[model samples]
Target: MPKSAVVLLNRPSLEAPPHVEGAAEFELLDVDAPHVRVLDLGVTRGDGVFETISFGAGHPQALAAHLARLAKSARALDLPEPDADAWERAVLAAASAIDPAPEAYVKTVMTRGLEGDGRPTGWAYASAAPDHSRARSEGIRVVLLDRGYRHDVAKTSPWLLAGSKTLSYAVNRAVLREAARRDADDVVFVSSDGYLLEGSTSNLLLRFGDTLVTPGLDQGILAGTTQGDLFAFARSQGLETEYARLETRKLAEADAAWLVSSVRHAAPIRRVDGVDRAVDTDFTAAVNSHLIGRTS
Candidate 1:
């Protein structure tokens, strides 16, 4: 199996091996070093916060936004406040070490350290991004899956970590697996009452003529960095945007839809639940050009 090239942070003594073949370009740095202990809560109970960022030509685009989101996630978990300065330095170091590839992903993770320890274990690394050409250009088939929660669960059930992007993704992964079993490429998670929520790993966006629609942050969806950024970009281009309670049936009524993320950027959805829709090439290109191309 091919492995992604990685660059370790805060561990100077470790040595990274050479890169292995993979879907996208990457460079390795310090692959053999172990950075965490078995007793850490992050590993033991999936108690941690994370952010995935996209870097191109050695520069991290939207890095500040990602770090801000990471801090919010940490706060939601009541973990120790992250040292943003330190994380920024580490991310830059990793990015500097990576040989320039078309693009790569840098994921920063901060776990509540050992169960009894107040210190948090935080580190970051740079790796190759997964190839999303097919999904981006050819489009993807998605299935709607029930998230088994009410849209307002985030407000009523804070313990659910509703809007936080934590390391606990067992349920999210399971939903994607189910989507695969249904012969779909991705998922759009809907709430129990039939409101569209988000994707297992990405945020959902729908196009209705000149408008871009997404489930509101109040609906318990992880406040998506890419989605928010794209909305801003779209509005700058004179496109109207909205945040509303989307029904499952709304998928078939849209001009187009997409699953957006940091690493993958914006992937157009060609079909939803086996129903085909016309791919809006102009809309996709405009949105992606801003979302993926704007690296500064």
Candidate 2:
């Protein structure tokens, strides 16, 4: 089997017409081949939605939640609703085609196809995940940057697509570069109005005594699938969970913190703007163990 695999969906959305009149639901393709068109809106305008699902021992973690989020992102972009069953099958197929590993990820993307084509392009690409042991164990240094939006941006200006996980992530990538310039590893975006938002590509999680708090969804942050699972796990372990509007100062005051996401799982925040912070080593280990052992 190849180290990586790709499955191109013929009909990403049942609401829209198929790519071909009569073709298979999807096709396994060469990972190195060019599949997208130059004029595709997803290529030219970054008009699309995506979800990256991590697989543990070949079982895709939080598969249902990821698909639901993908559909939600599609709705936010006014794109056709993704066919969950089809996407699930495609993801599984791609996952199976790749070499078995302790950790792997399958990324599903649905794009607004060529202008006026009225058809969308969708595919799932699977590959073994990168080694995140160093960051997960030693933790990461984070810097707070201004996201240039208000906490109420999602409600006030939904057109900005604040909470949607779209293909346009230039700003997200730029934040990491800025963090690098500041001698940090990652970023936590603060709203222009002085509210803590989220990480560049993950959700902000903080520990306050025995409670785990994260910025509320209303703050224009993506509803993190990994964070959701972590919340459930925390509850099972007798930790209280909350979603609230957090101020920038809250990050510094927290007992321990992390930036949680799918591929990276939970990376504890050990430093902020060069200042050291405490890390809950025991809890972090337990969190990662549960994440890596998930079968559903």
**Candidate with the greatest TM-score versus the true structure:** 2
lDDT of 2 by residue, 122-142 (tens): 999999999998889999999
Which one wins on lDDT? 2
Evaluate residue 186 in candidate 2 and report its C-alpha lDDT on the 0 to 100 scale: 99
List TM-score per model, in order. 0.90, 0.99
Superposition TM-score, candidate 1 onto the true structure: 0.90
When summed lDDT is taken over every stretch of 10 residues in candidate 2, the lowest stretch is 111-120
Q: On residues 1-296, what C-alpha lDDT tens digit does candidate 1 reach at each position? A: 12344443332111211122232222244556665789988899999998888876556888888888888888899876666765777777666665667778778887776776555666677777777777888898999888889999998899999989999988988887888998998899899999998888899999998899999999889888889889999898899999999988898898889999988888899988998887888878777777667665
Residue 88's C-alpha lDDT in candidate 2? Answer: 99
For model 1, the run of ten residues with the poorest summed lDDT:
12-21
Q: What residue pairs clash in candidate 1, if any at all?
A: 15-30, 16-30, 16-31
Error of 2 at 29 (Å): 0.4
